[model samples]
Target: MPDASPTLGEAGAASVSPTAVLTIYIPSEAPQDKVTRAIDAILAAHPWEVPVIEVSETRLVMCG
Candidate 1:
């Protein structure tokens, strides 16, 4: 399941703690190269210290 937990950032916090968790999704139908580039750009722009980033159909869940 995707992360349905409430997040501090989403609650309008001024800053996110280093341990805050976030979820992102890329639909399977999306272009692979575009997905790669988009993820790369996100990494370049932010200092996300996530321990793991899984990209598979099993975890391809997203909420509208």
Candidate 2:
């Protein structure tokens, strides 16, 4: 049987599956301890882990 999965040209088909973006904008004047705890909590909530091969200033290169 042919696959029922949506192809690239289909509407609402996300180019990257299971995508997430983490963006935090704590003011520079915020307390260090509070900021640290907030960041820790956010990270703890999303516990998914991937095997990253390299990390740079701009991007993360994950292992295939």
Task: Tell me, by lDDT, which candidate is best.
Answer: 1
Point to the candidate with the largest TM-score. Answer: 1
RMSD per prediction, one decimal?
A: 11.5, 12.7
Instruction: Please give the lDDT score at residue 32 for candidate 2.
Output: 82
lDDT of 2 at 50: 29
Report model 2's TM-score to 2 decimal places.
0.44
Listed in order, each prediction's TM-score against the native is 0.46, 0.44
Candidate 1: list runs displaced more than 4 Å.
1-17, 48-51, 59-64
Residue-level lDDT tens digits of model 1 in 1-64: 1333334344333554665455676777888899999878767765534334566664546899
Worst 10-residue stretch by lDDT in candidate 2? 47-56
- Residue by residue across 1-64, what tens digits does model 2's lDDT show? 1333443334445354554565555666778899778866765675333222232234457998
Instruction: Give candidate 2 misplaced runs (Cα > 4 Å).
Output: 1-17, 50-64
**How high is the CA lDDT of each candidate model?**
0.60, 0.52
